[model samples]
Target chain A: MAAVKLLNCFVSPFGNRVRIALAKKGVEYEETAENMVTKGPLLLSSNPVHAKVPVLLVDGKAVCESLVILEFIDEAFAGTGAQLLPADAYARANARFWAAYVDAKMPECAGKIWKVPKGAPAVEEGKKEMVGVFKTLEGELGEKPYFGGEALGYADVALVTFTPWFLTYERLAGFSIAEECPKLTAWAARCVGENECVAKSLPDAEAVYQFVGGMRKHFGLE
Target chain B: MAAVKLLNCFVSPFGNRVRIALAKKGVEYEETAENMVTKGPLLLSSNPVHAKVPVLLVDGKAVCESLVILEFIDEAFAGTGAQLLPADAYARANARFWAAYVDAKMPECAGKIWKVPKGAPAVEEGKKEMVGVFKTLEGELGEKPYFGGEALGYADVALVTFTPWFLTYERLAGFSIAEECPKLTAWAARCVGENECVAKSLPDAEAVYQFVGGMRKHFGLE
Candidate 1:
């Protein structure tokens, strides 16, 4: 077996995605938490392009980009552990599509909630857009136990990482995600309850709230 | 075999990525050329989320996003036609990484060149940045016949689609891609020359120049 090492940052939803995937796959690997503010040589050398975290090192070969790393893990560990992607081609495409959606929409919406002043217009507009994004995701989820129907799969791994931030978002933005998108909120809870990997890997809600609060204060938004 | 249909716009480099992949795979497919200005029901219905072009409809299922659609074609036709992705997992990841680099960097850089006035400071900065992007890609290419070394693989399919636009970009931006990155230019020419799929799929350079010129005029930048 090739030795696996994950270089990550503790609070990043992106890094947490890799952790959730690795845990779900039952892969035992060493992890190095990096100081993202003052990035180390390993993080810089591993991902020179983006210089972001959740880089998976397999036999000293680095895979950057969380989504790309997820796909790589699925491919590299085919037939072992749980399958992150579906076997059918169309289903796989659908999963990839929604994962891409989560990647594109989440940061912008989440940033507005945390990075802007409490009463800023950007926050107001972003809250509305974030609700719409959740509604669309709810529709995609439909009545499935998971985005992968019965299994916690690619899209699940992509999204469930964000659930911990919902508390921080709601408190900061002064909106209730549970009220607006009940189905998605329930789905998120189900993901946490159903998978120990997800539960163990997600950061504590209060801690995340404090972290975001500190960030907001540091940026002079609070 | 399932009936394949491609919803595309003639001049979009994204749509061209799909065209190159389908052609490389030798997949017989119906093509629907859409007027992007007034999108049709087919494109809208197939891809409600993005409503963008290069939606590959296979047996009535739509796959949106060019890179995702490329992977779909490779997996769906695993043993037939040309292999779009490298067989080795690491190699495939590397190809995907650079293909993603092109996708990420191309639009912003290319937009700067053609969208702004020729002598604007933004254009000058953009030209320097574009040169850097190509230089990094040139480093990735090294001496490989293709980005995939000996084969026209995923990265090649993603990138060669842009070769036709080099002419339009050069003419509008008033810079020489050949001078900045000679090897990548040579590789682009080699891609068009060596592959029937690439040759047949790409639009004529002069036609692209005319289309871009028309777009610039319409946008009042001409």
Candidate 2:
């Protein structure tokens, strides 16, 4: 068997995603957590294009990008514990579409959600944008228990990691996600509460919010 | 056999990418050219999430996003023609990584590579960023005849469409891409010069430059 390893940051949503993917697939691998503040040589060398984690190494062949890594896990471990993506071609495309959405919208929303210093940009626009994105997601998730129908598949796996940031996402954006997207909120709760892999893989949302708060203060935003 | 159709814009790099992928795959499809400025109802209804062109309809099932469309073509039309993606798992992941890079970087670079009035954001930073992106790409290309090693594949399809905008990319950025990255420039020339699919699909660079000049004038950027 090829030795599998993961280079990651404990708090990174992308990194945690790789964790959830591997845990969900029941792929056993060694973990090397990097200091995201000053990314180590291995992470930098492994992913020179982006120079960010999480990177998965299968027998030291590095694969970067969370979405790419997720696809890699599905392909590399074809007959593992569970298949992450759906079997139907159209459903796979739909899954890819939402996965792309999560990557594109989540980070920018998270970055803009922080309370910044005066003279810095106002957060209202960011808040409004986040609300719109969530609503769109809600519309897509309409009446389905999960984005992948009945199972927590690729689309679900792609997004569920963001629950740890939902508190910060809502608080800094000055809105309640549940009020705007109750089904999505409930879906999020269910993913973390009902799914053991997601539950164990995700960090606490409150802790993440507090950590971000401290960073804001350190940068003199508070 | 499923009916295939492509919704596209003549000058869009992404739209052209879908065209190239299909041509390379030898998959015959009818085309509906959309007015990019006033996108029609079909485009809107087909891709509500993005509402962009290059939506491939295989038997009326809409698949949006150029990369997603490309993958759909490879899977849905497997064994019909040349496979655009490599057979190897790692190679497929690498192709996807660069495809993502082209999508993430090219549009921003092209948008910022326009001559704008003062107090409008400066173009220098965008130019520098584009140069860096090009250099990274050049290094990746190395001595390969194409990004796919010997043929025009996914990564090639992803980026080669940008050639029509190359003159404009160089013109506004105030750097000759040929001078900055000769191998990449030569590779670009070779792809369009040698590949029938790429050659027929791409618009003329000089004409695109002149058309963009008219648009700039319309926007009163002069």
Candidate 3:
């Protein structure tokens, strides 16, 4: 096997996506934690365009972008442990669609909770939008144990990384995700409890809350 | 082979992305052009979530999102005509990265030109941002004939859909893309000349210009 290394930031849900994927595949690799505040030379050179973390370095070559890197891992390590995406073409496309949906909707909706004043109209609007997004996702999840249906697959991996942030979001936004989307919340707990990869990789929710709280202060939001 | 159908809007570059990919694969399919002003039942039913164009229906199953549809076409029709994405994992990841970059940057930057006032400082700022994006893409292209290096591939298919709009953008923004990123501009011209799929699928630049002009007028910009 070619030597593998992952450049990641501890607090990033994007980085955790890679970590969980790697763990699921049972791939042994070195991980280097990066200081997002003061970016180092390796990160700058590896991801010159995005300058973002969760870059998977294979031997000497670098693969940037978490989703792209996830696809690469699945493709390159096809014969290894677990399959991240589905084998069926249509199913894989479905998984990709939902994963992309999570990416597109999460940041903007979640950012408002931490970035905006609590009493602001934008925060309330953001909460409404976030609920709508979660509701759509819940509909997609339907009766399936996982978004991939029976297995903790692509969409599961893509979304479970955000589970830790639920607490932070609930605390800041003043609404229970469990109250609004019980099935989705239950699915998240199932992932954390049942999946070894998810269990090992997810950080403490309280830690994430503290981290995000510090971030709000740093940005002069609190 | 399953019956394939594409629901699209004529003016959407996203729909055009799926169109070009299907054309490249030499797949015979039915296409229905939707009315953007009042979306029809099929469009609404097929993609209930986003309610957007570029829905690929295969054997009555709908695949929404243009990028996902492109990947589906590539995977489902593998070993048919031209390969949309590269076979090599690393190369495919690179193609995906740039295709995603185009998706992320194009809407905001290109959108400003048409959405904002003709002589607004924001339009100029948008132009500058667009040039920067093109320069980064140009650097990615380097001296290669295509983004896929030797052949028209995923990134090429993803981006060439926007070529018709370049003339409209240039005319609207009062800037020359050819002057700003000559290599990328030349590459676009090369794609139109060499690729039958692109040549046949791309609408005329003048027609796009007229369409956009009408759209601006509809919005009371002109």
Structural similarity to truth (TM-score) of each candidate: 0.95, 0.95, 0.98
* Superposed Cα RMSD, model 3: 1.2
Winning model by TM-score: 3
DockQ numbers for every candidate? Answer: 0.75, 0.84, 0.93
TM-score of 3: 0.98
Best by lDDT: 3
Candidate 2 chain B worst ten-residue window by lDDT: B113-122
| Winner of 1 and 3 under lDDT | 3
- Residue pairs in candidate 1 whose N, alpha carbon or C atoms collide under 3 angstroms: none
Off by over 4 Å in 2: A118-121, B118-121
True contacts kept of each: 0.65, 0.76, 0.97
Evaluate residue A21 in candidate 1 and report its C-alpha lDDT on the 0 to 100 scale.
85
Candidate 1, DockQ to 2 decimals?
A: 0.75
Candidate 1 per-residue C-alpha lDDT over A74-138 given as tens digits, one digit per residue, 9 for 90 to 100: 88888678888999989999999899899889998888778888788888778888999999999
The C-alpha RMSD of each candidate to the native structure, in angstroms, is 1.7, 1.8, 1.2
Sorted by DockQ (best first), the order is 3, 2, 1
Candidate 3 lDDT tens digits, B1-222: 779999987778899888888888888899998856678899999999889998999999999999899999988999778788878999999999999999999989998887876777778888889999999999999989999998998998888888889988898889999998899889999998998888888888898888888777887887
